[model samples]
Target: MTVKYLICGAGPTGLGAANRLMELGENSFLVLEREAYAGGLSASFTDANGFTWDVGGHVLFSHYPYFDALLADLLGDDVLTHQRVSRVRIAGGWVPYPFQNNIRHLPPEERWECVRELLPGRRPEITPANFREWFEVVFGKGIARLFMAPYNFKVWATPPELMDFRWIGERVSVVGLEQVLKNIILARDDVAWGPNNTFHFPLHGGTGEIFRRLAARLGDRVRYGDGLARLDAEKRRATTQSGEVIEYETLLSTMPLDLMVTDVLSEAPNAVREAAKSLAHNSVHVCGVGVAGLRPDPTCWMYFPEADCPFYRVTNFHNYSPNNVARPGEQMGFMAEVSSSPHKPVDKAAVMKHTVQGLVNTTLMRPGEAEKAVTAWQMDVEHGYPVPTLGRDAALAVIQPWLASHAVFSRGRFGGWKYEVGNMDHSVMQGVEWAERMLLGKPETTYGA
Candidate 1:
């Protein structure tokens, strides 16, 4: 069948496009999803123990009013609001997030060192060539060495020198020297920094609940289990793995742009294919542990900068919602995220074991508690984070325009390959804007081709 709009990968982006198309009174679109269910990486799974876990740590927060209105209409009162209480484990102590702003939590010697470097005429004046240089220039040697440098390496799985700082706007917290000194002198914790300072989660189905309800609304328009096998840009046709050919006037793909160019579009230009290669990403290993006892603290999530833990961050999943645990108030759960890439290799077979030990080492669990803790679930997402490498923009410059020339719009986290605007809200809005652009000739402000 020929479709007016063929949406690829029923994640937030595709769902947003399909939903907008329906809102515009258009019924000729179809959404194809490879997974058995919708939500893609945003999907959730209930383990054998009846504990619900998401693909990773997904929090609901929005920068768009339209997205806010849509979520309110969809979820209504069935959501749990949370004030983010996050921390970073560094220098053998717990410091409130935005570690640079709360140096008072550090040891006296460490705190003094931080202040010493921030003093007048202590910082070096140099143009930053990369993220590492930017860190050292903006945050002095002390904060950079103590937390920023090491913590970022664990998260990105790539050297800071290899990444670009363009994606760091509002994502990373930057504090002035005077404020740091005043906070250190007064012993104040500036924890709330980013857009996710306050977020929401579903009361029952995990992060995937939002997408599931969206798919239900889309109904037959969203087809599951029919993965795209190949695409002929010249013919505007897509072949599925199940031998179904779908012809479309325009293709809106939310799949990873790298995969679309390398695997799906066989006739893509060699230069475009090579540009896709320049896109870098890290794989994520999510380890969910169910503990018998209640949580020891009220922390929503904690970041580990030290090498003592295999995981970079651990979210108290049970704290997100009572429904996350099989027995609310009686059982607890921890969702740990570990990133791996060519720079950092992880042993998939030993990730669970290492995660258990990491919980103990990081004091999230007691020494003997490892034996009692149950491995509720584990997942390795091949395309976890789209890294903002130095060459990413230049590569996207080549890839996006070439695809657009063929009536294709690649939009999403991995689709656009821009981590700066790759959050859930941004991803969904990309699709919403894409549909508006296609149907009404409106400019896509979220992501420009």
Candidate 2:
């Protein structure tokens, strides 16, 4: 079969392209997804015990008005708006998030140390070479050592020194020295800072519901279980695992670009393959625990920087929406995210045990409460986070342009290999922009295309 546009991966990017094509009154496109469902990493699932858990801690907050309109139209009254209540577990106490702004909660000595570092005119004047230096320069040594360094290490699963700071826009909270001093002096908390401070979520079916609805709207254009097995860029043909061959005028791939170049394209250039090796990413392990009692706190999520916990972040899934639990207002749910890479390997088999212990260690659960908590679900996503390593931009500079020359647009979280534009809204908009560029001659501003 021949198609005008043969899109790979039915995740947000692919769906975005397909949706835009339909909007333009075109039906010459096809979306192929390996999974039986859509949503990619944004997907969600319900456990055998009836508690719902996302792939990780996914919350809906968009920077684009188009995405906001699309979601508003799709979800309508089924959306639940939430005010983010996040905290950090540190020094045996809970500090309001943006840890730098809440030094008043730290011990006397530590608080004094942080204040002393933040005192007038201590800022570094040199340019930061990497994320580590950026953290120390942006936040003083006390806050960097206390939270930023270890916490970021746990999340990225790579040394801060090896990653780039360009992708830190809005993702990391930066505060002025005066604001820090004021908060410390007044003993006040500054918990609200960041785009996701107010977000929305589906009232039911977890985060995956949005994509599931999108795929449903697209109808038969999206073919699940038909994943790309091989591609012949010269012939403009793709072979699926089921042995069906397809020819396309142009291909838009949302698969991991590394796998696309090295594994799928048998004749990819050696330089592109070598550049793919320089890209770094971490795998994520999600563990969901269902407790028999109501939620203990109203907090949405908590971060852990200490070694006592195996996971970096934990989300109170039950609090995101009441319908997330099998028995609303009765049973509660918690989901923890653990990141692993070559530098930080994780034993998958022991993840459950370690996660349960981590819950107790971080005081999310009591020792006796372990008996009342059931392991609802556990999942390992091989490409959880696309790291912004020091060499990432240089590598993408080599890979993306080459693929574009081959009539392939690799765009998405892992496909584009840009963590700054890796959010759900960004991923979908990348697809829309790619389709617009292909069908309407529009230039993409999000990915700098």
Candidate 3:
């Protein structure tokens, strides 16, 4: 009954790591979950009328081969591969996503302005110091003015200039002047430009289903309702809220990196605690609105860049799959995803009313139609999606290697804190790779890259 690894946090990253351990034919690990169930931010909730809501918009995209293989293994025939049809709503126009790829979607005058600005084409040769400068270089002034500037502001909840551009690999679409002009003239759709051009979803269950299957595979190795309240690192033991002490030979923490180092590593490591404290995170507020009518469209998710609405994005949750909410001839649901800042406090009353108002104003939901057809309303708050600022590397520079020395490897959406590789696939590999490194001394991609 002795465990080899004690993992904290039952989020996708935690479960993913546990799954890798199981796959290695080694079950000497006990996963500690603060929550009663699996799927940290990816988990869903059910309201009175069987309405379902994810923490926010949980889309699956993968960059690693092992992640794809494992998801296929877990979902088997239940996986529903989808072509991404995401779009952005800009000042009453429907433009193809990655606005850079579809500059032709803009009006003639706007397009002319973009081209004119590029003609001067100094194409500044300076290295991009931040996200704003980087965006301007890739998309030029006109397109940046229309979408990139405002859209990114809403999503990041910070001035883009404050964001570091190092996270930009293939995640951000970069187009040349010729490519932009060609896309405009051709009006071609390049929606599937990133790593998740065609992604998979569980047919019957929500995103949480993937973890449920992973947890099922782990069986007794996974513990629910067993919250890890404290860690006795020197003794290689973790104490739960109920005063139970579980010992392990090695620890792979998938919890947020700061919490893991500060709360779990109790040996008073020098400068580590301070570095953890220096790290910053942004919290997210997810609102789910379930309607009693057919969906407006089969679109999976829509991005809102205009400031008329408080929410930045809205997902046609029911369109992801019929089983995502209720069955056919059952009911329909919609989710509005809003992000807030620590500097800007969220007023629930105003947000709720404004969310409804914004939905109507944007014509996403018809006036009074909402009142008649509305079935239920729910909101989920997850300190979800970490912010990648310039100071991050400096902080991780001090924290990451320190934890490794203690046999604790932290990786995940916020665990290793790289937004680029923090999706379901990436988080799971964080665990698997961490375990592989522990077992076989393999290089850890979660922390390394």
What alpha-carbon RMSD in Å does predicted model 1 have with respect to the real structure?
Answer: 1.0
Q: Candidate 3's C-alpha lDDT?
A: 0.76
Q: Per-residue alpha-carbon lDDT of model 3 for 56-97, expressed as tens digits?
A: 888777878887787888889987778888878875777777
Question: TM-score for model 2?
Answer: 0.98
* Residue 141, candidate 2: alpha-carbon lDDT: 82
lDDT of 1 by residue, 24-92 (tens): 988999999998988988999999988899988889999999999999998999999999999988877
Q: Model 1, which residues run further than 4 Å from truth? A: none
For each candidate, what TM-score against the reference? 0.98, 0.98, 0.93
Model 3 segments more than 4 A misplaced? 122-125, 327-330
Model 2, span 302-371: residue lDDT tens = 9999999899999999999988888999877889999999999999999988999999998888779888
lDDT score for residue 146 of model 3: 79
Runs in model 2 lying further than 4 Å from the true structure: 120-124
Q: What is the lDDT of candidate 1?
A: 0.90
**What is the lDDT for 122 in model 1?**
77
Q: How far is 223's C-alpha from truth in model 1 (Å)?
A: 0.9
Position 121, candidate 3: lDDT: 54
